[model samples]
Target: MTPPPPPCLACLLTLLLLAAAAAPPAGAICVPRNPGGHSKPGAPAKPAPPKPKPLTPAAPAPPKLTPMAPGADIVRSLCLKTDYPDLCMSAIAKQPQPQLPVGKRLDGAGVLRLAMGAVRTKAAEAKAAAGALANDPRTQPLARGPLHDCVESFDDIAYSLDQAAKSLAAGDRDTTGTMLDTVRTDVDTCDQGFEEREELTPVMAKHDAELAKLSSNCLAIATAAGLR
Candidate 1:
């Protein structure tokens, strides 16, 4: 028979047996109750990534406008007096700088002269355009006769304009106005031929319209300045 164990040894063996019985099996896994909090002791957890800020909208831009030249007040005021202010503005503004009196200033009489010069150049250009259209092979058969009429009318207009210039130089405002009226009438006559024939003379019509506006401006300037 074997001898019995001592009391202390027996107690230690009892504790070891209890611990083995409470442990997990060989193939079993040990899981934590709170996996999120499972980190190294005393080590701070990484802060969650910062949220992105919302975007803001932008405002609309202002409208763009044409820039006016410095010291153009006289030109602007003169143009305002005309029936076709916009046309007057462009015509006078396009002249050579030297043609304008010192400091780009002009009295009523000077403005009248400037307006007349613009009309004279425009009339010549219109006459040439009419002649070109009349001779063009592509001109419509019905439009040809009207185009020729426009050319002849432009010739009459040129003569009238020359007379008007002479009268203006001689300080004959009444005669100048009369000649300008004739010029305007000749332009209308040319346009009338096309209208009566029901023919489209787009090129000639454009020239006629421009010439009419120039002449009208000249007449208005002449009337206003004649009072002085």
Candidate 2:
């Protein structure tokens, strides 16, 4: 048995025990009391909102392409051989392309025929114009004679073009060329007939020039194709 502590020491020991009971534990957090007299724990910090993924743009559509005509290259190659490539191209362009079976296309001879056809049509028109001028009473006497000659010359041109086409079909390239030359001569004769009288008929002259170019194109195309 030990002697009792002094009063001062006992009072000090009681005060230390009371202080320990009132104090918080080692790792405890202190929160301020709310107006309702309750101390609630703080909510966990809200997770940062997920960042929106960057938007991706869509790709643009491809451009539309124009389709090329069949045998266009072949026609262009042939036209390059002519003195009047534009005229040749224009004439051939107007012609309707035959719907050949697949794998087949226009040959040089077929293109030559198209040129010949253009010449034939032009010749017929010139003849009709000359006939019209001859029937017009307002026409001068000298012009009438030349116009009549022109009409005859165009008739011959028509016949020659026909023969040329036939000869081409027969594989007679030399005859075809000869017939083409004859058509050129007939056109020249019409021009000379008017020139002899120092006269000019605008209609006949225009026709003559167009026919000359068409005939020349035919010859060039034939030569290019090894037909002449």
Which one wins on TM-score?
2
For residues 1-228, what per-residue lDDT tens digits would candidate 1 score against the true structure? 999999999999999999999998999976655457677655677799999888766676887977865436656776788899999978877765435555755566666666767777787788788788778898887888887887788788879878887887788877888898998898899889878864474566777788889888877767665622
* Pairs with backbone N, CA or C atoms under 3 Å apart (clashes), candidate 1: none
Predicted model with the maximum lDDT? 2
How badly does each model clash, as a count of residue pairs?
0, 0
Tens digit per residue, CA lDDT, model 2, 106-158: 89888898888888888889999999999999888778888899999999988
Cα lDDT of candidate 1 equals 0.77
Quote the lDDT for 16 in model 2. Answer: 100
TM-score of each: 0.62, 0.69
Q: Give the root-mean-square deviation of each candidate in angstroms.
A: 7.6, 9.2
- Cα deviation of 24 in candidate 2 (Å)? 31
Cα deviation of 180, candidate 2, in Å: 1.0
* Segments of candidate 2 deviating more than 4 angstroms: 1-65, 99-102, 199-203
Residue 142 lDDT, candidate 1, scale 0-100: 82
